[model samples]
Every structure is written in C-alpha cells, then in structure tokens.
Target: MSLALEFVSTVRADRSGPVDTLADVDGLTSWARAHAAGPGFTASEEARQETVRLRQAVRALFARAVAPEPPSRADLPDLPPFKEALALVNATALAAPTAPQLSWDDKPVLVIAPAAETDEPTRLRARLATAAVEFLAGPEVALLRTCPAPRCVLYFVKEHPRQEWCSTACGNRARAARHYREHKK
Candidate 1:
C-alpha cells in the first residue's frame, strides 16, 4: 500500500498517542504522485504555515476527545466562515450519534478532512478542530490516542490487539530499558 494509504490506515486504527497533524502530508502527496491519482498535491509554504495554525486546532480536538474540559462553541474564536463550518459539522455530529459516512466500502467509513487545502489559518484551525470532534464522536474514532512510550508525543493506532507505543522503536527502547534495570540488579 502507499504511504498515504498507510497514513490513513494508521489514523483509522486504535492506539493512544499524540496525533501527527501534518507529518504524513508530504509522504501522502508523494505516494499519490507515484500511484497516478492525478497530479501530486504540492502543499505550498502557505499551506505549511496553515498546518502550523492547524496544530492548535488538532490539539484542541484531541483535548476535546481526551480532556475533561473541552472548549465551548461560545469560546471559539470570532472568525466567521470557518467557525460556521465548524458549527455546521459539529452540530451535525452532535445531532447524529453515528459518524458521517464517506466511502461505500464493506466497512463503515467516516468522513474526515485533511488540513492541506485550508487557505485561511483561522478557518483551517476551525476545520481541524471540528474534524477532531467529529472523529471523536464516531464509534471508530479510537484513532485518537496517546503514545504509550514514556515521553514520545507521536500517535498511531493500535494495529495489533496488544500494541501500545506509536512505533516499534519506542517499544524496543522501553523493553531495553526494562532489561537494563533487571540485569543491573
């Protein structure tokens, strides 16, 4: 499978870790180019800047998903358009317990937006934040998780039933640390 596919797959999986808001955008565009899925998406420097703006949005969504006190709609910024989009989506999700369906595959697919095309930083932030909330409401949104590795902020799904850390590197490091402690005794 392509890196984009892997990125999507990982996002849709179950695990606890910090969400990798934009790490896979370049890889995804690369894979999209290789697979001939139209021209590769070249995220402009503006997009990169937008991604930075989206960090707070994504983080806020994660906070809503895992944190106790989530921001209220009233607490949202004064930006009009993105906030409106967020309200629309958020209200829809709130009204419907089930996630919005996207693909027609055998398995249920929940639609979520990527931060790549957001033109306005404020709007992008709103979309990502809204998307995160929408994702959190879904039955399949176990996608939002924290890395089990002690200090690692990277997030990924728990592919295996017993998987924990976002990557095997973190898992190995943890295991090695355990071994060192035992052997030193």
Candidate 2:
C-alpha cells in the first residue's frame, strides 16, 4: 500500500468510537515513526491540530467522491489543506537529488536513489496529498466506496466485484441488520 493510503487508514472507525491515530502530539509522532519513517518528526500541539484538520479535509474529499450524486463544481469539497500539502511534496521532490547508481554484483543493476533529507512530516503530507489527488482523478475512483455497515464510517477501495462492506465484520453486521429487519416485518 502507498504511504498515502496508510495515512488515510490512520483514522479508523469501530463500534466503540472513531479512533483518530493523529489525535495528539504523541499519536502524531508515533504515526510518523511507523508510516513516514521519520522517527525525528516534530510533534507539537499545533502540528497535531493541523493534522486533524487535514484529515477532516481529506475525508470530506473522499466523501464527495463517493457520494451518490455527482457534485457540481460549486458543490465540490474545498481542499486548501491538500493543496498546501501537495505544494510541500512538490518542493521536496524538486529539491531531491536522484542519481542512478550501479550495484556491486556479478550482474550489475542500476537504481535511482534520492538524497536523504530531514523534512519527514512534509514528505508524508505530500505523499498523502498526491495519493488523494491521484485516486480522485484516476479511473479507480469508481471503486472508492464508504462502508455500508451500520455505524461503519470507513472508506475502502473495493477489490472484489461482489464486495460491499469494508470488511467481513461489517458484512456480518449488515447481514444481521437485514435479518433483524426481516424478523421485525
């Protein structure tokens, strides 16, 4: 999975409640360490708050994409934060030095390696923004769907043709709900 997809999954929903992995400074730090490979990513209260805001904006954009009615240009979700994040990512990419190096093996293999930079958080954010834009603009946008299970608020990229819910647990919940509805009738 791409880092951007993993970032989106950080905000998960369960029966207890929605778990925002980026809720606090510590959480943000932990997430950055795990996903962004940035053990030294700065974690401040302001950063946590900014992450939350960006998460919400990203979620809103997904919601609009998967909505039943195609949103008009005026009705499209505003993505100022995503734009900012993308800019940061673009700047980082532009600054990165990519050079091909030959491996010291009997069979030589060439690889393009990017220079190491310390801007971890910005890189992660840029990855996420780029991914979101790609997902929205790509043909797979049709496969993007919100979970239909009761109380399930997660979004998933549908893999199977018959897959409806986000997971088997959600599928069971939806089936149980349908059975209960039938019994009630």
Candidate 3:
C-alpha cells in the first residue's frame, strides 16, 4: 500500500485502533471497517470527536517515531490503541532495512517481498516496512520528507537532495510569497 493509504489505514478506528484492550484484534477490524467507509463514517458528534482524537493521536505517534523530539514517554498512557499502532509502526520500521539501491519502473509500483502474504494486515505492514527502507535508502534520501502541508503528512522521496517543497503547489505558493515580499520593498 502507498504511504498515504497506509497512514490513513493506521489512523482509522476500524483497522487496529478500535480495541479497548491490546490483546483483542477486534479493534483493528473495527478500524478497517471505519476506514473503508471513509472519514465521513463518523456520523455522530461523539464519533467525530473520537475520530479526531484517534487521528491526532496516531499522527503524533508516527511523527515522534520518524522524527524524534523529546522525552515524554513517561506521560503516555498504556492504551491498547497506542500499543497496537506502535507495534505495527515499529515492526514496519524494523523491516525497512537500508538497501543500497532501489529500482524504478515506468509503471508506479511498490513491490514488497516478505515472509507472509496470507494476512492482509501483515502484507500491508511488510509493504510499509519496505517503503520505510526505500525512503531511508534512496539517493537524495536525506531529502526524503513528509509533505509540509499542515494536514498532509505524507512522505515523499525527493529526487533532488536540496528539495524543500513536496510539490509545485507548495513551491509555487512559497515563491509567490517571496515575490510579494520583494514587490513590497
């Protein structure tokens, strides 16, 4: 699965974050169901709030793992949702080895070669693991970065080492702002 999809999947309450207890996998199934129906599945106000909470919680968790900030592990709660998500993320991170090279295809495809293919979740996790490695290992890999768009936290492997924007939309906006400033001078 694509990084964006993976991110969405991880955040949804149906897939893996729904279970109240870490031992039960029902929460993951709930998350998957919620995710399949789309973000709008949060029909009620309470559900909406819960969805938002989950999204923020999951995003923070991922951001911290990929881009470590500080020592706040003590403040965290022992929630099953967090534990399950962290396990998935960590496992993926581990699977994502630092390969010296990656191949390019005319068709956009991400091939994941892992031990298990029977489980959809496992396959998804493995794919993410491969992607993490690819993002970390590719040329200009240092430039591999997440979208700076506030709500858009998707990752992209930059073709240029010095790339600052994830797309022309962002780059153009930044340039326009600069030009506006220059004209004000």
> Which candidate number has the best lDDT?
2
Note the Cα lDDT for every prediction shown: 0.45, 0.65, 0.43
Tell me how candidate 1 scores on lDDT.
0.45
- Deviation of model 3 at 11, angstroms: 9.6
Candidate 3 C-alpha lDDT tens digits along 1-185 = 34433433342122232322112344444553443333322233343333334433444454444454321221135323556655545565554233333447776555534443333443433444444445334443444355553233344445676776556766776677778889995
Candidate 3 residue pairs in backbone clash: 13-31, 14-30, 14-31, 14-32, 15-28, 15-31, 15-32, 16-28, 19-27
* Model number with the top TM-score: 2
By TM-score, the better pick of 1 and 2 is: 2
Each model's number of backbone clashes? 7, 0, 9
Model 2, residue pairs in steric clash: none
Root-mean-square deviation per candidate: 10.3, 5.0, 11.4
Q: Tens-digit lDDT track for model 2 on 1-185?
A: 55555666677766786677887888998888877645667777876665665565566666667778332222124334545645543453454344678887789999855445535554555455556666767877788877778776667778899998779999999999999999995
Arrange candidates, best TM-score first.
2, 1, 3
Kindly report which residue stretches of model 2 are placed more than 4 angstroms away from their true locations once superposed: 69-118
